[model samples]
Target chain A: MDLKDKLVSSFMAFEDGIDVNDPVHDIRSEAIKNFETKGFPSKKEEAWKYTSLNNLQKIDFSVFPKQESALEYKDIKKYFLHEIDTYKIVFVDGIYSSYLSETTHDGVDVCLMSSALTKPMYRQIIELYFNKIAKKEDSLTSLNTAFSKEGAYIYIPKNKAPRKPIQILHLATGNEASLMLQPRNLIIAEENAEVQVIERHQSLTSNEVFTNSVTEIFAAKDARVDYYKLQNDNANASLIDNTYIDQKDNSVVRVHTFSFGGKLTRNNLNYYQNGERIDSTLKGITILDGKQHVDHYTLVHHAQPNCESHQDYKGIYDGSSTGVFNGKILVDKIAQKTDAFQQNNNVLISDKATLNTKPQLEIFADDVKCSHGCTIGQLDEDALFYLQSRGIPKKEAGALLMYAFANNVLESVRIPELKARVNKLIANKLGVRLGFEL
Target chain B: MLKINDLHAGIEGKKILKGINLEVKPGEVHAIMGPNGSGKSTLASVIAGKEEFEIKKGNIELDGEDIEEMAPEERSHNGIFLSFQYPVEIPGVSVTNFIKTAINESRKAQGLEDMPANEMLKKIREKAELLEIDRKFLSRSLNEGFSGGEKKRNEIFQMAMLEPKLAILDETDSGLDIDALRIVANGVNKLRGSDNAIIVITHYQRLLDYIVPDFVHVLHDGKIVKSGGKELALELEEKGYDWVKQETVA
Candidate 1:
C-alpha cells in the first residue's frame, strides 16, 4: 500500500498503545482526517515547485518503530555540544532515552513531551501552548500532528533564564529497512525569560530514514529565543523540518540553520510578528555536493506596526547538487513602518549543479520597507585568480572564496562553542584547511 | 635572476606583448616606462602566469628554468610576485589570515612544516613596522573598504611578507600621495639586496625618483623602443612618452 494509506490505516493500531479516553486523542484524530484528505505535497504546488516528495513516498516506510534502542554516551558523544554542559532530551527510535538524557526541573522545565502529555501535573501547560502556533493546514505538518507523541518540551517561566542551553537530539537506528519518524516539539518562553536550543536529527544506519518533524515556539513579551537547526545526517537520510515561531511585543527570536549533508532536505520556517517592535531573524548556510538536494522555503508575516525581520541565506552546490530558496514577505495593512529585508546568494560549483531562487513580497501597507535581492552564479573568477596569485592552489583558492562567501552569517551565532563547531563543519565541507580561524 | 626571450603574448587573439625581451640580474632594478595600454601590466601578468593571456610564442625563465607550463601558484612558489594594479577585495578574510595562508601554502608545497605562531607573528610585526602600518589594519578584512592609497600600501605590505625573489610592481604608484609613495618605496628598498631582483612598471617617472633603477626601457605598441641607463627615465619624464612613441615610428 502507499505510505499515506498505510498511515491512515495505522491510526487505530497507533491509538491502541495509548489511552484512547484522553482528550488529546480527539485532536490527533482530527489531524489524521485532515492529512488523509491531503496527501504528500506534489511538485505542482507553487511552494514545492522545485522540491518533490514523490520519490520519498515510493519507499514503504514503517510508520511506527518497534521499540527502544540503546546507545552509549561514548558512541554518540560526538553529536552533542559535549564541550559545555547542556540540558539534553535525547530519543532513540522514537522512544525517550532517559539514560542518555540530562533533563532537569530545577528552575525551569526541560523534560519530555511524553511526561508533559501523559502526566497530570503538566496538563494545564500542554493544553495552553501545544500546537498553538503550528499551522493546522499544511499537509506535512498535519501529518506530524497526527503522530505527535514525544519530543522536547521546554518551558521557561516568567523572569527566569535557563542555566545552560538545551539540546534535543533524535537518532534513528537501522533496525528496520526503512523507517519514518514524526517528532513534535513545543517551546514556550514567558515574559522576560530567555532560552537557547539546538536540535538535530541523525541517522546511524545506512538504511533509508525519513523524518517529518514540527516545532512550535512562543516568545512572550520581552522574551528571547535562539533556535538552531543543524542538519548533517547521513547519505541515506531525508528530513522535512517544519518550524513555526510567534513573537510578542518587544520579543526577539532568531533561527540559524546549517545544512551540510543529506540526500534530500527541506525547511519550511515561518514567523508571525503578533505585536509591535518585535524582531525576527532567519539565517542559513547550505553546502552540498554529490547529488544532494536542499530547499529552503521561508515566510515572514508582519501583522503589527514597527516590526523588523531580517533573512540572509547562502548556499553552495557542487557535483550535480541542487538548491532552492523561496522567501516570502507579507505585510498587512496595519503593519506600517515594518522593516523587512531578505537576501539569498548562491553559488554553483560545477556545470552540472543547479540553483533556483525566488523572492516574493506582498505588501498591503505603503510605508513599509520590504526588499529582497537574489543571485545564482559561480564563484568570481577574478577573485580566484587573486588568491592563486598569492601561492594558494586553485582548488584551495576556490574553497577559501566560497568559505568567505558563507562566513558572513556565522557572526550572528550567539553561542561560542556552537559557532566554533559549525566553523569546523564548514571548513570540512569545503575540504580545505585554512591557515587560521576566519 | 629573471629572463624573458622574445615573449609574444596576447588575450583572445589580440596581441598585447609582441617580441618582448628583457633580463635582470640580482641586485638590479629595471624600470619599464610606457603610456597607458602600452602592455606594461600585461608583461607583468604574463610572467606571473595569468591564464587569461595566451603565449603565442617564446617563454619566461626564472633561474634558467622555463616556467611556461606552470600554474600561477607554482610560479609563485618559484619566487615570482606581481603586485596587482587593482587589488581585489575579499570580504570576511582578514589581511593577517590571507598572508599567513599564502605563506603556509607555499611552505607546504615545498614539504616544510607550518611556521610557528610566535615566529610568524614576529615577522608580521616587523613587516608592519617597516611599512609603518597600523596594527589594527591587519585585523580587518583584506582590502575591503580600503582607500586607494591603503590598497596600494596593502599590496606593498603583502610583498614585504612574501619576500619573493622577483617582485614586479605594476602601477603600484598610481593612487598614492607623496607620503605614501615614500613609505612604499622605502619598504621596497629595504627588501632589495644582492640576492633578489625588482621590476618597476609605471606610467609616471615620479616613483622612479624614490626607487631608482639601474636600467630603464620605454615600451611602445607592445615592443621596447628605447633602452638606456637611469638617465633615460628623467629624459622621458621631461620630454613625455610622446618622445618615445614618435621615435619608434621614425
Candidate 2:
C-alpha cells in the first residue's frame, strides 16, 4: 500500500493505549480523513510550483518509529546552543526522553503536549487553543494534527517571563529503516508576557527520515515572542515546517530561521496582524550546497490599521543546489497607515545552481505603504577583485564578500550567543577560518 | 624598478593601451597625464594583473622579472599596489580588519606566520594616526558611507599599511577638495622612500604642486607623445591638451 493508505489503515492501531472517546480524538479522526482525501500537494499547485514532493511521497515511510532509542549527551552536544542555560524539551525516536529533558512549572508551563492534552487541569487551554490559528485546509498541517500527541507545549502567564530560553529538539534515529515524524508545538504568551524559543530537528544516522511539523503562536496584548528555527539535518533527512502566528495590539513577534544543511526543506510561515499597532518581523539566512534544496514561502496579513511587518531573507547557493523564496503581503481595506517591507537577496556561487524569487503584494488600502525588493545574482566581480587586489586570494576574497552580503540579517538576532553560533556557521559554510576568531 | 615594453592591451577586443613603452627606477616618480579614454587606467590595471584586460602583445617587467603571467595577489605579494579611483564598499568588514588580513596574507606568501596580535594592533594605530583618522572610523565598514575625502584618505591609509614597492596612484586627485588633496599628497610624501617607486596618473596639474613628480609624460591616442621634466605638467595646465594633440599629430 501507499504511505498515505498505510497511515490511514494504521490510525486505529495508533490509538491502542489512548482514550478513544476523548474530544481530541474526534479531531484526529477528522484530520486523518482530510489527509486521505488531499494526499500530498503537487507541483501544479501555485504555492508548490517551485517545489515538488513526488519523490518523497513515493517512498514507503513508516508512520511511527519501531522502538524507543536512547542517546548520550556527548554524542549530540554540538547540535544544541549549550553555551547558555535553557529549559530543554528533548525527544528521541518520537518518545519523550526524561533523561535528556528539563521541564518546569515554576512561573510558566514548559511541558509535553501529551500531558497537556490528557490531563484535566490543562483542558481549558487545550480546548481554547489546540488548533485555533492553524489553517484548516493545509493537508500537511492536518497530517501533523492527526499525530500531534507528543510535542512541546509552552505557556507563559500574564506579567511573567522565563528565566532562560527554551529549546525544543527532536532527534530521529533510524530504528525503522525509513521513518516519518509529525511533531506539533503550541506557544501562547499572555498579556505583557515575554518568551524566547529555539527549535531544531536532527537525524543521527544515514537513514531516510521525513518530518511534517506544525507550530502555532499567539501573542496577546503587550506580549513579546522570539522564535528561532535551526535546521541543519543530515543528508538523508527532509522536512516541511508550517508555522502560524497571531498578534494582538501592542505586541511584537520575531521569527528567525537559519537553514544550512538538509536534503530538502520547505518552510510555510504565516503572520496575521489582528490588532492595531502590532509589529511582526521575519528574517532568515540559507546557505546550501551539494544538491540541497530549501524553499521559503512567507505571508503577512495586515487586517488592522496602523500595523507593521518587516521581512528580510538572504540565501547563498553553491554546487547544483536550488532555492526558492515567495513573499506575499495582503492589506485589507481597513488596514490604512500600514507599513510593510520585504527584501530577498540571493547569490549563486556556481553556474549550475538555481534560485527563483517572487514578491506578491495585494494591497486594498490606498494609504498603506508596501514595498518589496528582490535580487538574484552572483558575487560582485568588482568587489571580489577589490579584495584580491589588496593581497587576498581569489577564493578567500569571494568568501569574504559573501559573508559581508549576509551580515545585515544577523543584526536583529537578540540573543548574543545564538548570533555568535550563526556567525561561526557562516564562516564554516564558506570553508574559511578568516582572520578573526570565528 | 618597473618597465613596460611596447605593451598592447585592451578589454573585450577593443585595444586601449597601444604600443606603450616606459621605465621607472627606484626613488623616481613618473606621472602619466591623459584625456578621457586615453588608456591610463587600463595601463595601470594591466600592470597590476587585472584579468579582465587582455594583453595582446609585449610584456611588463618588475625589477628584471617578467610579471605578465602572475595573478593580481601574486603581484601584490611582489610589492605592486594599484589604488583604485572608486573604492568598493564591503558592508561587514572593518577597515582595520581588512588591512590586517591584507598584511597577514602578504606575509604568509613569504613563508611567514600571521603577524602577532599586539604588533598588528600597534601598526594599525600608527597608520591611523599618520592619516589623522579617528579610532571610531577604523571600526566602521570599509568605505560604505565615506565621503570623497574620507575615501581618498582610506586608500592612502591602506597604502601606508601595505608599504608596497611599486605604487600606482590611479586618478588619486579625481574628486578631492583642495584641503583633502593637500592632506593626501602630504601622506604620500611621507611614505616615499629611495627603496620604492611611485607612478601618479592624473588629469590635472593641481596634485603635482604638492607631490612634485620627477618626470611627466603626456599620453594622446594610446601613446606617450611627449616626456619632460615637472615643467611639462605646468605646460599642459597652461597650454591645455589641444596644444599636445596638435604637436602629436604634427
Clashing residue pairs in all predictions, respectively, total: 0, 0
Cα miss at A84, model 1 (Å)?
2.0
Q: What is the DockQ of each candidate?
A: 0.81, 0.76
On residues A216-243, what C-alpha lDDT tens digit does candidate 1 reach at each position?
A: 9999999999999999999989999999
Candidate lDDT values, in order:
0.92, 0.91
Task: Please report how far candidate 1 places residue B224 from its true position, in Å.
Answer: 1.7
On DockQ, the candidate that comes out on top is: 1
Evaluating just chain A, the predictions reach TM-scores of 0.98, 0.98
Q: What is the iRMSD in Å for candidate 2? A: 0.8
